[model samples]
Target: METCSLPRRKLAAPLLALLTTLSLPTPASSAEIHSYTLPQQAYSGSRERHYKVYVPSAMTTPAPMVMALHGCKQTNDDVLNDWGMKAAADRYGFILVAPFITSYDGLRNENCWGFWFEQHIHQGAGEVEDLHQIAQQVDAAYSIDPNRRFITGLSSGGAMSMAAAVAHNDYWAAAAPASGLPYSEDSSSVSLSGQCPGSATFHAVSQVVSDLTGEVDNGYPIPLLLLQNKNDCTVLQTAANNMRDAHLQVFGSGDFKTAATTKASDTSCSPYNQNNYSCHRIAYTQDGTTATRSLVETIFYDGPLTTPNAQDTDHGHYWVGGAEGNNGKWALQIGPSYPDIIWDFFSRHSRNGSQPQGHPVIVLQGDNPLTAELNSAFSDPGATANDLEDGSLNVSADCSAVNTQAAGSYSCLYSATDSDNNSTTATRVVNVVDSNSPVASCQKISASPYAHIGAGRAYVGGVSSLRAYANGDNVDIGGSFDTWSSVALYEGETGKWYSQLPAACSGTGGGFVCQNWNTTNLNHVTAGRAYYGYYTVGGNQYLGSLPGVNSWVKETASGYFQAGQCSN
Candidate 1:
């Protein structure tokens, strides 16, 4: 909820530095570029174009597909050049497919997704059809799980993504639109008992639900992911919030306020509580004009999930899987690892095509390097409030004890007391390192003094690599053959830390250069620990390390925000 408008001095310094380094790679390089050419003229009248896809080797199975749509006046390559989806795909196996939208307003490649409800030469339905055909073509060629298909966009493309989802109920499993106009039509009010005819009839939000999954069945419903930032000027965050409540209602969830808080809550959902969907909303602000200031929020609804979002500080457009450019701002603004969370949701829920196993279970991510000690007084519910409420316990590992074979990995035994003082025992194998594990010590660097793009706009970069001192006989690091990477946020005001990289990046195949962003090379750090990792944004790549608290001071902005060594 805090807005970080980039200061003019800070902006100018970074921009100047970027101008000098635009053609050179920073000494701490973390990522490389991977490009993909679009199907060559699969259809006549098609434009000769190629899309750059970032696929991380961390992906094991053929991951889900995220189709990122570009905004008006933006080319697919430009979007790809900006979002850094390739880094996310490389960190996780999910496939990223970004489609190019041709420019219609005299700007080449500036045209947005075919306007469904907007004034345009192409009907929104036609645009949706074209997207569907492209997805079909890609699915046939690759091992994409169609059931886990997702779509997202920004500005015109953002609104278009929503409209496309509405038009093709059978195609996208879920959709998220950042800084775009709200649904031009009310979709929740319609009763989806019968066939939906005409665009107007399908406009209602509720009708979208029924059309996607036949029969308007309440017991089984598709999930919807919603990400909105407060204080957003382009597309009002408030509208996105309203849409969340509306979509929940369409899912047949009732309004129920929490006992402790006055805010209305819903029970029909998990991860993001039924009523407290706002809790999952990620908000941040920066300097710059309309194109640069906007941030992104990724939502995953419906079912069939995989690894959640992955984190990287890449300023490129491939920040989030298939979604790139303006969409990447929305993706990375929420920190680096969000794509992994999105993919996790896709892989876990897509295969079944039905509801999840039970109440949303919070599985602990096991990427931290330290080891955690379980409370000897463990019960059937484990320990702490989260356990009592959600049947899970999230405890930080002891950083000093990390690196042992047992580092970030521990076993816990639990016993329960019955009404008559009876006892039962339960054993659990806790994987402190959720995805790939973290390395012990590494030479870390950061973009503390990030470069500024313009008013309210700035770019940050950092990197981390294995340190010889941290990897000795004392450590047992054998999770993945590839190295891992991560990035964190230090509150400019509070001097606290926010875990930025959720998943580690690794390589699919080492080529002329090494690409390591996975468990073997890098591992997850404890929630409140300092670390480093590789970050990629579009064509720009850098190695960033976590800075100590209060590393930045609000000086006259003549120099970079200098930070000190992080401490406990």
Candidate 2:
């Protein structure tokens, strides 16, 4: 319901859900730059606002919008150009809105986003509220995609972006705060607001969110890509660390899980620095869900130093690595392609409830992890499809690609479409596996139970300890007793093979005495693979398998049988 234009949002879309690979029609961009202004509020000394918008050349209808906020002493025009965001806009087809700060205290003569002002910190009040209104007005003019709206900025711009996200958490799809500070109880105080490593002074993301939207919870946790330059002098690494901790204080506990990736070291990135400042990415996502709505991902770029912004003396502080990347001011050119990264992260998410969902449904009619005997003929179980607009639909299954003659996993993809060209696809894995093979050996031995022996050993289940060694070997099992378990020294009358112990074995290990007729002899057998049991006579021994799936040593081998091959 919290959309760019609530009137045309959900009702405008047909029953077509967003396709995994959507083929949306491209719209011609107006290529016109437009500017707007909003008179300051009745507040004592609030200044009027100025902002600009640029629609990409080949933008998508209801396109996404990115609010490019500038750092201290920098104007919106500088951010749109010097940060290489305008070029990104041209390439990605999103509406770019650059917000300029007009208010200046008596002391400071530089343009800066008022992230720490008491009025700006709260939603629907000051500078932050003005930025929000600009977003709404841009959508009113261009019909922007409500689900894809985004906000990102440099130093102070970044801090303001964080505030904007918390204040209007339901409005933005994602926010990337570069070298920005987290919300603090002392954020209103200019001196204390500059404190780093919010561990001691920062407020929990939940707390500020609660403060901003009291009794109005959207339940949509804002996804964030916290950016930092490891070599940044203006904003120390502690600030980034504290920012991370504050978000984690709320997202770290429950369904969210943390995963890490190492940085890539490339020496050919920027002329300024000769080291690869590949992003050290730490992503946190909810359990059972991936590819979208990330709780937080902290990226540390340790690249070469570059020119500083006019307001500060910090290098490696700007957005890095774009086709037209700017390193003149608060920009770094050697690190990761931030534009592409931001777009990719932004594309994965949308406002939680804003997604239109009358899409056609196609559900496969069979077991998910299905299986067939090795080299056996298989048939597609097929699927049923239905749509809200088109009603019941004919479903087509692409099962010709499934090769049952080969052992391993294949998929049967089922797809369906509504009258409106809205379509969906479903897939089921068809695992072809080998039938259980016998674990026969050369001779019979102990009858005592050994816990180490597992499945596939079941292939020779019909054979008993009392049975003579008939493995094509002429050796006769010498039993002066009634049975191997009941009586004597189980030695072979013909061969010297015998049990190492005088006790009786009751389970599958009893078959180990027989010769193992395997692939070396016949071509119908499959190799057992990937760990079921570590059989050691005493302790610590050797074992082998194929790898990936097929734990033939397990008792329930048929159930977990996957990722295996059947061939000579």
Candidate 3:
């Protein structure tokens, strides 16, 4: 953690009041600001350190201490500007501390947290000792609650926080790491010592996590609140998943399977089920972008830190230190609402091998994308399956509120779990599209397989084809037939009704046999009725008409013509 303390530059009365109101509360009404000097030892020599502290005014007795660690290439003052842990301490009424790392080049200017474990803390013994000394000094100076001490950080600071949990587990009640992972690094020039809080050392948090579940090899699972972003380009989301899985592999005893899932564009989470500890992973995926935020909440079945379930702060830098978030830096900060959620989780948990309260758990969608409806169940011991496996839990969710946009009734059926060790057995279904009437086209047709036919003449009957093509729509052929009554016949040469046709030409010139003199009607004749009526099938049309007579003959005034005919 970086340590330079930011001065209390007074603000406008109104603005100061507003900021003060925004602070999380303590029993006291005001928070005090103070600074301390710490001594540290380096591979080459020794040095002194500095850090800032904020004490809630309402706390008469020892109040909880929360240490905030800064990220890499950042200073304590820089973190203060980016991460607003001080404001959170004032509002929440908890003691806040920010420690600084020292440089070994005798400059004391290139500040950095010394190695987390004694292995490195020894090389720079003064720096680690300075941190411990400051804590002791504060313990003596005020009502500092030793049992309720907590540590949290981001990036490199986050890794250091893990080290702190391993190296100083007795000093902190819980640990929260944002966008960070366990150390697997070897010694390097930049980092003089092997990782701090190495696997060889297991503190209270890790020991309790291991003891409850039964894993001994991995770094102990401290009472932890893990947050990561699925879409984070810098830190891979897989690391967070691995951490959650390790917990379940050691503790879970029932039938639940872990699942990878997302709800919107901003985040995502992995699945884990074990006795006492239930994995709550959140992923935000909006549009095509992956959500860069993840939250890991752990609870003890028994002990002073037992809670039904833990709530976590958002992980996206966009929402960090905003009115509703925790962790991260950039344009958007964690919100004011974040502190409460963090405290709620921490207050209910400890790495003491205690049984979780087994509180009835409910899952609800937050403002983020990876959300499911509230599910009620008892977190039981052992491995537990998804809620869908039991056919009792409803993981249907509405994703319309994501990205602060008004989405139209979109929902999803997802997998989930409860405390009872049961699994989801059925699929949940939801509808998101509209059910309004379809759009209209320029034309319409009969139900199915329908066609128009030509009215039969007095001596002939035939079928007429009607084919209409409409834009943006299709016509149905309902296998039914109707007749067209608009056909009229007239003599092409005489200007009169010429109801006759030319007979076979084998005889004198061309024997006339009631020739079809209606030029207009004859000109309109073509091919089959279904087609455009242009081609002739062997010099004749397939009009359902009587045979044995001159083909193209107009019907008499009685409305009958002579042509080929078929079955009724």
Assess every candidate by TM-score.
0.41, 0.51, 0.40
Better of 1 and 3 by TM-score: 1
| Error in Å for residue 480 of model 3 | 68
Q: Candidate 2: global Cα-lDDT?
A: 0.55
Residue 243 accuracy (lDDT) in model 3:
47
lDDT of 2 by residue, 1-568 (tens): 0112112223322211111121222234346565666556554435677777766776656677898788876787777666666766765567888878866554332776767666676666777667776677566566688888999887788888988887788688889888787753343322222322222245555564445445224567778877787776555566666565555544444534233321112122211122236656666655524433567777677754433233334344566644456544566544465665566556556675343334565544444556878777797766767553455689978877778788788888888877778778878788887655332222343332111011111111223543333222323333212232321122222223233421222343432232222221001112322211222121112233221212222111121221212211
Off by over 4 Å in 2: 1-30, 43-46, 105-109, 185-217, 251-276, 288-290, 308-315, 353-568
lDDT of 3 by residue, 1-568 (tens): 2223222225444223212112222223555566665434333334565667777654435466777766655556545554556665654456777776644342211343443333433212344344554555555445666666677776556656655554555555677766554432211212222332112221233433443233123343345566654433333344455544443333333332132332222222211111112213332221212422222352111101111111211122221343322222331231222344455445444344232312122222222222222221211111112221132244433323322122133333334445564323222222222223221111111221222222112122224434321111222222224233222222212211212221211232222223233222213232121111222222233433211112343332122233332211
lDDT of each: 0.36, 0.55, 0.38
Q: What count of clashes does model 3 give?
A: 124
> What lDDT score is found at residue 269 in candidate 3?
20
Tens-digit lDDT track for model 1 on 259-372? 112122222212221112232433111111122111222342221111122332121122233222122232332232334444444433342353221112232222112233
Best by TM-score: 2
